[model samples]
Target: MNKLLLGIILGLLAGVVAAIAIPRHHDTASANATATPSGRPAAPHDQVVRLGKPETATQGSATLRPVGAATIEATAHDPHGGPDWAVRVYRGERVLTPRMRQQGTDGVIGHLKCAQLGRIHDGRFGWLDARGTFRPTPPQWGTSSVVCSTPNAAAPLIGTLSPITDPDASAARVRSTIVWGMAGPDARTVRIKVSNISATTQRATPHHAFLMALPARFGQHDVHVGVVYNNGHTASGPANTDRITLVARAPDPNGGLPYGLVTAPSIVPGGAARGETCLFGGGVRVVGDRAGAVDYRRDVLSELEVNGGGGCGSDAQALRKMTCLPGIASGTGDTASEGGDTGGTGRVARRTQRSRTTITMRCAPGVDRVTLQTPRDVRTLVLSPTAHAALAVYDGQFTTGGIRWTAHFQDGHTKSGAVPDVGF
Candidate 1:
């Protein structure tokens, strides 16, 4: 079956979901299913495969309204590295989008772009305006770069651009929701803790959508997925806040590479379905488990995630080695609660040289405060109770000179060092 036709039980992440039916939470948590590839069958009418408001078949379920350009000024090189492309709205000035065409009953989703930019570089969805006025409404949910492209091909941008010839009409044909920031490499190392045992797999292509399985015994409350850093701090999403997806309810015997696995389209942790021009503050993440539950939450720790790279296929037997932690709680970072998508949680804002950049760090236990010093700014953040982390939103980027930082622990002990500029 088609992905849109497939029933998706989205947990409460806060957005308009559409499909054949809305899923319900159950104690079973699909106990009959596991994340491990089973080449399972299709889900029934009301099976709560993943956690969330199930996609519904009802018309008008998911709608798109174009939002304003996050930044008034923007610039980028042409794909061929030719002249800067036309489309001046990205240069500055508030430009209005074409009106969305109404189709009476069955009027649905569509794309939006600055009238001036036409079909080139700048375009976004989910900002409804009658004329040139920017009427501020609550942010639209599930906006991805489906339209925007890297060399014309990248992760799909669901609501941003158009396959439609007329902007007004595509807006009348909107169907489902969208998720963003899902850029990953050709291969990645995904680690999961199944009953306190740490297992790592580099078998995944890790793009668009994929699966990580845990044993059938695990529930939404028992899974966590995301990128685990070598420093022990993890950018993850917990199982609670409804971040579990079971294969039995939505099987994909031929998902990709390592067959039998399914792909859940655009998983926004905490259901960050809202829209923005450009977003920041979080990074991309993914994880694998056997229970058919993958936990991806908000970028709580504010770590940087690596993407735009991943392997082409997954090796089912590639689950190479296992490392056991003392206990579940023994792992640092992500304790419990909310989630994040590929990008950490932050409103859309274009990052400029002077724009504020968020700096975060995970400290050893007893660490109470962390401070950073850069040529342009100095920032300090106090760790929250039960949190071995610190966050500072300040100006300037980490440059070649590096930034000086210090981690202050409770015993008055201080560890200071210069964090080097980073790149992969």
Candidate 2:
């Protein structure tokens, strides 16, 4: 998977080329054609509407009543070229922006504000909802305030994107809806539907999923390099300084369609031949020398869509589980984990969920295996470090429930395991 942060590096290159490139195409039809190769019809813009204000508290089918939620549904066309599309709901400023490709890697990762996303110390599946909302939190003074300065802290999950519709065309149209109602007294959800979108499809395992996180930062820690099998025995290989590699067979027992997600560089022109359920979800753990130097915060924004638009990849569903080793304190947790070394460099600051501390780590180039622990959540695990050094979290316990899990490596190895740790 091409690191979304790489887009920033590319964006920088775009500026250099923009001056010498041919004139921009002004034909809407031509541009639309380039954006939508799937032959799907575009949904009307009116389909995008806000449902209503959320109620303070309301009963639902479950014990936890929704305090606030919004439902938005609409359809929109894929004006750009891509294979898939996703509606990303973000409460703070945009992380991956179009202009990012022009900036340096540091500038790109800076936008993510990885510090505020929460803690890997807990060892639970920590992440900003791909579609969520947040409210502002009281500003902390000094680094603290800088770490948690989200604009709409109260309703953070405010942005969303349509799903990837087709894989055969250069681009596919999409329709999607975003819903929010997790925090606060008023429970509501937002639903927005879009249409006529095209997205790319490739063979991905763990790394492809990590690319979606965008603007990643590697903490100053020892990168734990090893081969993780589904059986639960991780062979500590050499510490990965460049990119860690994992190769597992496709989900299909017969190896059809390379049934998993991969990077854009790995995909063929015709797309996978079979096994279309491959999906990714996981995180990384780094062991660093300094703990205080480590920062675990992140702010996912609305800009920097893939292929110059918006969308992510998907594949087979798998179970996921995370253990929090309190004893473990390697600054190597994902940007969301305990602090470590900062990967890129920049001052593009964005806020996160109110009160949430933002830890911005440097974006590394590697593969993150996403473990499917439950139907409601997914955990992405990184196989290596971006800088080819050692840094990671340590003394952490894990919490897992009822779910089956699998691990695929770059060397064509595979393993399976039951979710670990029922109670944390």
Candidate 3:
């Protein structure tokens, strides 16, 4: 009886051991089946994972949250709902996403970036408004700081002249003030050169203001003001010139004063040498018989209107005398006048004369272009290395009343001169 009982106990113990081992083996197999290829446990299904890095972008009052690396999922919010009411993503100045309207809300979600977003620098999202105005946002993720320094370029120089006060057309004098924009920091010194067809004056100041007492003369009186900055840089202001007209005042019948017009000497014979014309007066003559001449008459009606005729009767007589005088004649060759009737009523018949004039120009060492300006049209000519060219001048009823020349140099410098006569 004792042996049988011992055997029975051993059998029960073996059965219990087998059962425990079998269950342990099955549990190991189940765990192995769920494990990754690298033998690590699989991640949870709803776990949050970051792929690469985070970035931020801010512009105006709006700021964007960090972006996801694998996809473009970001939020942009404005505390004050700035003027830029549209949101978009950008890689520098280039747009990365289509513009979306952000209305009735302070924040917007942008679906912008892609897997390659990591390749961009200072990548950011920005905002725009209906007016096509853009506001940039700071980079949310960048290798360097998102803020960039402002450009240090210089601003253009501009100038304005104060209204003339107490203008005395008879005395040929006027007072005015000229104000120019402040020079940039790069300017070592600021200087201005004021010039007209007849005279030129220069003044330098630490500030940008200049006062002047101008002497009004006849003809198209234009004052050219140019500024010189440091490093030999120069710029010219807009063409703002004053036109002066001198009307002949009739002599006092009672002999109170001499009754004569003060014609500029240069316009008259034996005044200045050839190539010099009376810029202040309306007289131009070319010396030498070879120089052709063209008859040019000033628009008397326009002049009368501008000067408010001293006295209709005397001014009319003066105008008649002016018409009788020979008009501007070009000095190219023989003189011939193509005659035509002035466009006027039969009662006041005026003769129109036309003549051909030849103009020869010699360019400065580096002049690349030359522009000829006449009252009727402007002609521009490109100069070759020879720097010599000739232009034809026609004097007619519909021709440019006056002539001017401008030369543009290779170094970006420009010089201008008034064409005194037909020949240059």
Candidate 4:
């Protein structure tokens, strides 16, 4: 079972369902089987995965086109040695099977050459990009990536990296998808969710792509970009010479999966696939809102994008415990909420510098609204008194479950009270 061939077969099945749901268009969502936290098989197709349109298959100079909507369904075995896997693509009611090489009447699929782009950073799990947008047409969903296997690997081993001659494309890797759904005619907000159902953990990069036909000279200058979180505040980055790169630490060191990527063949202007060259001007500009910094670089010609600092094989587990604490502000110069602390846990004590001016406290479980105010220099007030006493911080959790507590600063001393604990 070659990954490319598997992709074609799965694409055909997905096309059938896609054609029905969206006659003029096709939609794709990736799904994975589930397993217990203790490493036991749960059920087939237990996890529902989705990939939004215009997602980036790999971070490289070559532009990757959108393939068909792909859905992966794997079934766990009783012995847990291996899982049954199947991939499906959606076009119209006409679901076609993946073709390795076209034969006879298979011209329709054969003409559409689906070149595998790259896998996600975690090995055995990646994505494929075929050519198509708006509505899928023949030759649109040609290229695909399928699962391959290797020894002691959690991520699916991806098949070969077509067009590009890279020896690393040895195995098939598991691939994940990002899904976005919105409500209302205005499309006010979209609920974006992602899942990793393979045997490995997949890192999801949140990105927004703008379609623009730049003048041939466009690559000459850098572009300043900013992204607005669900909150009204925004994080701005310097003019990026290439693309953006943002790295997030894994939740648990051992819980994350191993990922890798290799550049595929480049698509020339005349529709010919050629070996990729360094002359192309394409890269990324990664920014860290929490860290309040930015880093940019050229597109990865054939490199794996790993999270934090280590490769997927590296140990990500933290040597020290990371703590989440909530504090309140009462009598202070200025109390502002800085980014939460890291690498401290279990009644960890923290100190603020005098120049800090504003004292922001990280919150524990069940806390919300942190407040800091000044009595003498009202102008120096970080948070108004109205925002004081009632202020609290959240338990580090992205959503829900907060804590209550207070912070007071006097005699150049700061003390916090009533901090609760929420184990990670």
Candidate 5:
């Protein structure tokens, strides 16, 4: 995916070339020209809305029962009754989904923030309804992670289990997160154990889900929440929580942030330069030692609304932030009013758009793939295993909007999110 951050870089690199096309008249038009290529009308913008009558999706009647004795509540919603859905823990009649508001020149504004717990297609499947007063306890454990394929029987079955980052929490200081999950029938309680050399245990039965926040110190692979169930007789089986490990808190300090939540050219290597940009292809090029730097090179061209207008390109040699290249390249913009293009000519300017833009990106850790959903096509980029942290070359475009991405973990789980791109 072309990083949404490319907006800043693309503006710097976009090479402005006045393309003149002489028109030729054709006597015939084919029947296929009259029909839209996709055979469907352009769909309306998809956004969460409140219907007079709410329709919640069961997804095969899937249900989540709180595990342990921690009194958990679950409710699902699908206001439009289709692809988009959000599940919340509230029992109130008012259902709060995502909404968009429009500004005068800023364009339509709407955003849905999600910590995805499951993967579906090219995106995350678990998006819960957001909007509520701050609550710091169970039963009212308003913030949660849920995953369900087919609704399971109320009890004795675990449906969703994933990590949690409290809503609007700061990354600079790691706050205590919930160790919450679903309980199956005969599932009585859950006990969480953290171990490095010695083991300390915490239970979720009598003690509430939200007590005092735990200290923010974590290493790796040293935690598990055991939710054992009583058998119909005596023989019992352990379910998902055994394999699902979680830390009650995240690590705090330099470069401290939740796993997979780091967006960069952050954390400059010792003696390396601060993040900066230059022109690559008629797009901007971000140059950084450790930050997420993306190079936008336009290989394709289309009817652009605005001609290229940017400053000079980068002067630094690759990876050599201190050394200088003899020549620093710069760009020139069109500044004449009596030239070929006029005020009214923009509506039907002669343009050539058969080319493509190739985007090279350096992504942060935990990002398996970067995708750009351009108006023309979707560009998928898979980072090389060893060089993912250093550098990787990929191809994509930096058109207006569409910068969605997915992060893959060692356990084969995926989390999806979007980054906003500036047009530069």
Candidate 6:
């Protein structure tokens, strides 16, 4: 009975061992079944296969491929270094948004949408550089296909030239302010090309205007402007398209004196000339031709009357009264004239004059001071705050020959310009 029991126990142990060994052999076969015949591990079910390295797009170049009715694959490059790029899908110049990303080259852009892409059947792509600048690609028509486009190749349009008075007459130059009426869609910068002139072209970008100064020669000049886009495309106006003719006027032979004074007018004209003089310190004087004598006298009087109630008028009256003397003139023209009298023992002088009228006036608002530099001497005038005219009329005797003027503004800006050819 003991031998039979031991035999039963050994048989059960053998059955358990065989059952485990058979399953282990089948498990090995199952594991091996998953491998290739060469014994290499098989790839994962979710693994992505890479084709190869992508080609870099040139600056301003765009490549687009339609993936679906509303989606597209796109790529672009920056010629000016590796700039992060964005894609803009377009039908003509109209842009659409909601961009997407897909696996592509390092700088390649992908996945843009234009719901009307297939409906329009004609569309284009625009590549935006890292700098937030964009240039459109050429239009692509027809069904799904690879579309490649470049930046706009057309030149920018140049507009009319506006003449600007030369700031410095002594500099012997003229200025022309040009505007870009139609800068092409791709133009990033505008340039003015001035040639066939003796002056060196001076260019400045002030505000949004393009300003240029060229020497004021005696003849005609060839002038044109150009523009350059971010994509390195450039366009210029037709050569010699704009003609600028500068007429040189001879300097005042009389040295800015309209007429010679035989006898100086009274510092203060006592009777009828109450408001004839500019009470604001500078007085009017009549010297040579008197064609506008009555009108000029009337204007001066009107100015004094209108400004008389203001602080400007009070100040002028006070200045004239302080400088005026009885019978004795202190300065030429109306320099010493005023409405009120300076307390003195002598009687006031009265005189009748003709031929020329010289009036000294104040500057316009924003002018702090004005300096007139001439061949003979320099004259400086500190302007009043209330002055509001750009040009100041001075006594006819003030010489304007070879005059260069510098106007200092209240805001610390200075404008220096040549005196008008016609004496001021």
Candidate 6 global Cα RMSD: 34.9
Model 1 vs. true fold: TM: 0.25
Candidate 1 RMSD computed on C-alpha atoms after optimal superposition onto the true structure:
24.5
Candidate 4 lDDT tens digits, 98-150? 35324554323211112222222112333322110111122122333312112
lDDT of each: 0.28, 0.23, 0.31, 0.23, 0.26, 0.30
User: How close to the true structure is residue 130 of candidate 1, measured as C-alpha lDDT?
Assistant: 11
RMSD of 4: 26.6
What's the residue-level lDDT of 159 in candidate 3?
34
Worst 10 residues of 1 by lDDT: 322-331
lDDT of 2 by residue, 1-424 (tens): 4798899889999997986686665575445333222233332321211222222322222111111221111122223321112221122232333443455542222211111121111222122211121122211111111222233233222222123222122112222222111111122221222121322221122211111111012221112222233434333211111222222212211111111111112122355433222111122211111011112222221111111000112211211222111011112223322122222112122232111111111111222333444433454444333211111211223333354444544454555555333353
Better of 2 and 3 by lDDT: 3
Listed in order, each prediction's TM-score against the native is: 0.25, 0.17, 0.18, 0.17, 0.26, 0.18
What range of 10 consecutive residues in model 3 has the weakest lDDT sum?
A: 298-307
What is the per-residue lDDT of model 6 for residues 357-411, given as tens digits with 9 covering 90 to 100?
2223234456667676654457665643433322233223333455566667778
Best by TM-score: 5
Cα misplacement distance, residue 70 of candidate 1 (Å): 32
Taking the tens digit of each residue's C-alpha lDDT, what string does model 3 give over 147-255? 2111233433443322111111111111122223333345444444445334333333332222222222221123444555566877654432333222222211111
lDDT computed for candidate 3: 0.31
TM-score, model 6 to reference: 0.18
Q: How does residue 266 of candidate 5 score in lDDT?
A: 14
Model 3 ranges with Cα > 4 A deviation = 1-156, 162-179, 196-222, 240-424
- Measured by lDDT, the strongest candidate is 3
